[model samples]
Target: MAAQFDKIAIWLVAFIPMPVAQGLGDCFHGDDRDFSSAPDEQRFRVRSDIVVSGFLAGDPQETDFHQCGETVKLDCATGEVLARETAGTDGMSFHHFNVGNTFPDPEGGVVDNPNEFCVNFLYDGAATNPLGPPGSPDVDMNVFFTIDPIGRMLSFRGATNAFPDYEAYASVEDGPPVVLFQQKHTLDPINGLPGGADQGVSATVAI
Candidate 1:
């Protein structure tokens, strides 16, 4: 019985020392290996945007697009014009259309240059008669606009069926009309409307 007790004591001493050494080593250093010594990882993420390219063609089915005698105003800031253009047609027309006008640089002062601008007359076949017969001739609409060098619409006048025609110019003798505006062109020797008569004497009609 004494020899059996001695063997049991030896076994316990041997087994206990192995687990204690392992526990001390584990507490000093973690179980995970040094993976940071390897090459660094390169991660990436991507995003996309949806873009619409062209004008909104006129739609006769919708009531907003079919409305007659409409006027629209556009406001542009120091930011992008595309966003401003989308906001401009909010209350005016259902169909979005673009006109020929260059955005004035926002940095430029008001008096630096009169921002060049023009407006479009949108007719989607609803505007056929103007208090007259259905067979009336098609006449171009006139647009009066005031602009700043900051690309802002200060004021404007627009009419659908009643006008002085497309080529009508304000006259001092003719008196003022319902809309307050004027049109005048400054002729310059160096610069004039493109494709105008080069000089006079040598000009010939084209075929």
Candidate 2:
């Protein structure tokens, strides 16, 4: 009976279709930008750099490819927005942004310190609809974030769906240096509805 079950499993595996190959957009990095001259000098200084690359299948003729969600940094205690930036239009599949010194903690107030903060990326399919029909497939959209602290530097990378739900919590002194919280729901090829994986990690860095 066990052998029969194994044979059946092998047969089912043979029928499973492979995931389609998707195109990644033009990649970008924040290192190229000099934020010292930004309007908000105090907050615009570069501290954390993020590089992103991915693709969303959209109407090539229109500017739908130019549309993407916003990324934000917030105070963990007060929930106030510290800084925000949009995924710029590069006419390609890739996007990138830098969270510079612009991510400051509450001043002399009772607000939490800079280390107690969180970063988020909001990706809505509705915003991308202008590029393609509803329920159209969007390939892998991902982000790579790096931070420079007093003693060391750390990095993290995560993959997102067409409609991404991403968040990152600052590390506590006693805990890991970075933690990523993700909730991504993507279109199912069979039903055309949202369904996908939910992954989270608390990453510690020694260097």
Candidate 3:
């Protein structure tokens, strides 16, 4: 069955508590700050560290998958590619991508205040028992990060599976977390659709 984006958003909002939801908002827009005003030279001096982590969730067989793409960091304002890391092997279910220090400015300076960035997690693999034939679809997971005025970190991950499942999470941290999980699914790229039964459960809880 095909998965609907609207339905997934509504379900995630319902699953998350009001406080957590508000916290996510704060991360994205709470603080009034921008990187445009900083001088070209000074901007390069400001830096924010980033770390990406995630693991497979649910039944081992159902969640069995691998990443065929890379994790990338993009400048929110210009949509420029800042850095990227390659995907891990199939045997390594838990994945982590760390860009220790990122300079958000064009001059390669650090961004000391509130700023926004995006991380993409892409995967192409098969499940042990997918709703359809294995290796047919690709999964694209995204995480958006906002650094508050004081450098507090807030992030959110939301992805729709080629299978009948979705995963999402919101988190706040003083520094980058040691690990994060990549949402999983089975898809058929040729047909451009998911190929599995609807597993009616919110995998966000695992986050």
> What C-alpha lDDT values do all the predictions have?
0.20, 0.27, 0.25
For every model shown, what is its TM-score relative to the native structure? 0.18, 0.24, 0.25
Candidate 3 lDDT = 0.25
Q: Candidate 2: misplaced stretches above 4 Å?
A: 1-133, 137-146, 155-159, 162-198
Model 1's number of clashes is 0
Question: Whole-model lDDT for model 2 versus the true structure?
Answer: 0.27
> Residue 186 lDDT in model 2?
41
- Per-residue lDDT of model 2, residues 130-180, tens digit only: 222355433233333333332233444444342333233333332332334
Q: Which ten residues in a row have the lowest lDDT in candidate 2?
A: 6-15
Which residue pairs does candidate 1 place in steric collision? none
Of candidates 2 and 1, the better by TM-score:
2
lDDT tens readout by residue for model 3, 1-207: 111111010001101111110111121111112222221111110111222322112111111223222334444455555555443333223222222234253234653432222122222222221121345333222233322212323333333434322332233222212223322324323322344323222222211
- TM-score: which candidate is best? 3
- 10 residues in a row with least lDDT, candidate 3: 5-14
- Error (Å) of candidate 2 at residue 54 is 26
| Sort by TM-score, top down from the best | 3, 2, 1
Clashing pairs in 2: 25-93, 25-94, 26-93, 26-94, 43-102, 45-101
